[model samples]
Target: MRFQNLMFLAGASALALSNVANASDLTAAEAVQEARRAAAERTAATEGQEIVVTATRSAQPLADAPATMSVVTGTELRRRPVQDLAEALENEPGIVINGIGMTRRGISIRGMSNEHLLTLIDGRRINDALANMAHADFDLGWVPSVAIERIEVVRGPLSALYGSEALAGVVNVITRRPSERLEASGLGLLGLRDGKGGDTGQLSALIGGSITPSLGVVAWGEYRHRRRTQSPLSPRESELEAREALSGSIIGWWEPAQGHRIEIGQAAIDDDRARDTVTTGARPVYYEYQDHITRAQTHGSYTGSVGWGELQARAYRSVLERVNERDQNQTPTQPTKATDTVFDGRLTVNVFAGNRLTVGGEHRHETLRDSTVNTAGKADVNHNALFVQDEWALRDGVSLTLGSRFDHHPAYGWQTSPRAYLVVEPIEGLKLRGGVGKAFKAPSLKQLSLGYITVAAGGRFIITGNPDLEPETNTAYELGGTYYGRSWNLGATLFQNDLDGLVQTNCVEFCGVRGRERRAYVNVDEARVRGIEVSGQVTPLPALSLSASYTYVEPRDRSKDRELAERPNHSANVKLAWQVADATEFNVRGRYTGKQTIYQADVPVRLDDYNLWSVDVSHDLTRQLTLKLGVDNLFKKRLAESSALYSFAEPGRVFFAGMGANF
Candidate 1:
């Protein structure tokens, strides 16, 4: 579809959804507001901590939560020069930017791969259909920057609450809520590099307010563009792909009567990216590749106060359409589509004194359409799950949580995940927490189909699917503690994850054939990952604050008795922020990444370590206007220029300026 048509359709749908008056109940909104109010009132009482909902699917103080969690507020995001979700989260502890095939990046927590991490928006999973495609980062660009309120990250397996895809952890992006009063905000940014290519620009706007005493609406939009960078040694081939992205969302809420609330939301994303390539062989060839992807989602939920406690139900559908084309030999365009539909319901109530219980069930259906699936060009799968969680207050300042989930899949019979967590407060300012959990990820539809085949490496290799594959599973354990002081806080966690039945491709046909190599998917790997994370924050003066975090991970392939690839052993982040004046703020940040080992064409390659620094300044010119300036990669470090084994480009020494308006 054309950009104009896509935007028009998305805008029209958002407008229509915003005008919806009668939908579900307002229980969720009311609960969020109430939680915020309570958190504000407790800001200075005893322990100063924020309230989080992702830990237990309900509002609770961070200090008392039984899980290892982190929160990045919206205010902190606006202070940095972040163009994407990965950039915004690079500073957090236990996070690494893992490169997928060549250019795509995904989040890796602890020592786990990106495939093990599950991402969600407002507690609903964002379908990851593009995961099967090599070098695709389509899932990270769905949410607009202006619509985000906060992000909650859990650093361990959460399969006890969520079903599949929560094998490693979860990241939930929460959007802003509608207000009773009129509110609006806008931001514009541009960046320029010292070299020939690699520039960036972005624009975003958001507005939200009440249309009636019982109704409210919020809408937002964003546009981003980036130019591809050129390799200094090889100017004919681009190191990065140029991209243009447009995204928007509209959400409406209604309170038909007291103690009842309903919400409806519509969101869309349109992404276009392309690159140029040149190949040298017996005959020189030039090629141009393009990928145009569009995604749309619709979700509705109802929440209300029930006789027992509270009841909530929700349903949503997500659809992704893509058109991919290459200009070598005038190849025809390849069109693929994927859709995910889910229905979920849950009830929360007090089971007895000092105990709270939650019970929920979910049904999910996924469909994929591609030319490689079969002659019919379609494949599908269905899943059903039931889960229950109970929180018991063993005594004052002590809590224990036990939960489990049972999932049934057509291809795979059944899988059960269980978790046990304990939180203890031994002193006035110290808390200790620990947990153990089991998680699993079902094979993708393409992986489970017998007729699936894909050609890669310029058609030199072919991979086929297997129907006798087993689901990959993980067992994890963690222990952590935190200390809160008047002017400082410290936390540390030790975790280990054991994985079995990992799926990989093996030689199935033409094993010795160089040009006609064939492989089929199979489960043939066992691995273990163990890591430790430590972080601390201190305020030496009223205007100055400093924080730092460090992580050390060890990942090994037990089946091969060797260290895994692409995982760094050590990484750290440090930041210093100062309020120079009443209306001005200055910040300095630094990051260190250790050396890594990767295999290249059956040969082991070692990549060198690197360091990066950044400086930022923001000044409030007026009550409603702000100006910002920043510099990234202050020393101009490029991986391609430093390491012979690395094959990616880094646009170093870039300057950026931006402005924002709020009312």
Candidate 2:
């Protein structure tokens, strides 16, 4: 750790303690008690209440939730200039951003792979067909920033309720719902980089209101564009890809009875991206590739009261299409499409005085069409699942939850996932929680189709899919606790995941043949990830607040007996916010990532540690208008200038400005 970083952390801690001690004439414990009382009363007035639903499929306060969870509200979203879901969540505890390509980033939770992370919108699954594709990052930007109400994040496996794909954790983006009163809003933003190229622009708008006594609707649209960035060392070489995207959604709800409601919605995103690069060789080659991608979905949901309990049902169809063309070879364009059709229903009932039981079932049909991989030009799979959960309020401030899910797949037969969680609140403002869960991830359609084959490394290698491959599985354990004071909160958690049956491509034929390598996807890897996360937030003054979090992890490949590649050993984040006046606010944040090890052609190489800092300021110009300005990468960090171990680009200093209006 750097000396300045250590000093910054220590100063923040000291300031928090000193403020509490000097804020009142009473002792430290007494002052905290008084603050708690004040906070409770303030919460009663509708300011400090945080209701989350992703953990148990039911509404509950953050303090009473049965899992390690975090929330990012609409207010926070508006304060930051976040481009997509990955940026919106990169600061949360136990979360990390990983670079995949020149302009693509992935989210990792506690060193887990991105493929195991499940994403949801309004508690419904989004399309994840691109998760296994090369340089694919289409699933992270479905919901526009202007339409999100809140995002609920669970930091551990929830397969017991969500089934496959929830092996690592879940991130649910909840969009704004229809309102009884009419409302409209819009925002415009522009950004410029310090050096050549790398510029950005965005525009978004939304409107919502009641159309009739019992019907309400909401609609929104967004358009964004980013210019390509060029390498500093080589003017003709590109560092970042240029992209243009447009997305929108419309949702409507109607109530025909006192407690019954029906909602229907449609959403779509169109993205066009291009990359340019200069390849150094005996004869220099200049190449460019363009990717056109589209994603669309339509869904309907019903929620109502039944004699025995409450019933909720929903159905949706999602599709993704991608077409790619290269300018150099003048090759024919390649197009691929994936579709998912699903039906799900769940019922919650009061099984006894203190126990609530939930039962649900789901069916999903998936299809993939790719002429290059599937000999028939298409492949399909079906999945069915049943789940049950019981939430028992054992006593005051104590709860226990038990859940299990059973899924049946044609290729894998039947797989079972189960979980048990306990939350104990020995005092009024503290909670201790623990859980043990089992989870699994089924093979992707492309990986499970026996006839699937593709050429790699310029036709030097042949990779084929195996239908006999087994599903990857995991067993996870976690224990955590949180303490909430009048003006501050603190939390810590310890977690471990045991993973088995991991899939990897292995040589199956012509292993020693120089240009005729052949490999098949197989399950023959095991690993484990263990870590600790500590976070805290303190509001020493009504106009100022400080928050910090730190994480340390050890990820090991059991089979190889070595540390996993691209997994950081330590990371941390810190933020300071100040309200200078009634209409003005300022924020400063910093992030630190420790060194990592990566394998290059069988040799382990270590990368250097780095830090990033940013500053943002916002002011309300009027009751209906606001202005925002910020500087990112304040120290001008760049991958090419800092180290040569990595090939991806790290953005340099950027200046951005925006305006928003509500009417």
Error of 2 at 407 (Å): 0.9
- lDDT tens readout by residue for model 1, 227-264: 77876666766677777888899999998987788999
Candidate 2 lDDT tens digits, 1-663: 222343344345434534543453344454445445434433421222478899989888877878888787665666656678888887788887887664678888888887789999998898785444666778888887778888998999999999899988999999987475888876666677898777766677789988887899999998777778887776776788887888999999998986799999999999888887653434566788788999999999999986667899999999999998777774534588988999999999987788999999999998888885567888888999999999999999889999999999998788999999999989977889999999999998888878877765445677889989899999999999988877778889999999999888888999856458899999988999999999888777666777889999899999999988878889899887777665667889898888888888768898888888989997665555567789989999997786655646766998887766666
TM-score of each: 0.91, 0.91
Q: C-alpha displacement of 429 in model 1, angstroms? A: 1.7
> What lDDT score goes with residue 204 in model 1?
81
Alpha-carbon RMSD of each model:
6.9, 8.7
Least well predicted 10-residue stretch by lDDT in candidate 1: 17-26
lDDT (C-alpha, whole model) for all candidates: 0.79, 0.81
Report how far residue 25 has shifted in candidate 2, in Å: 41
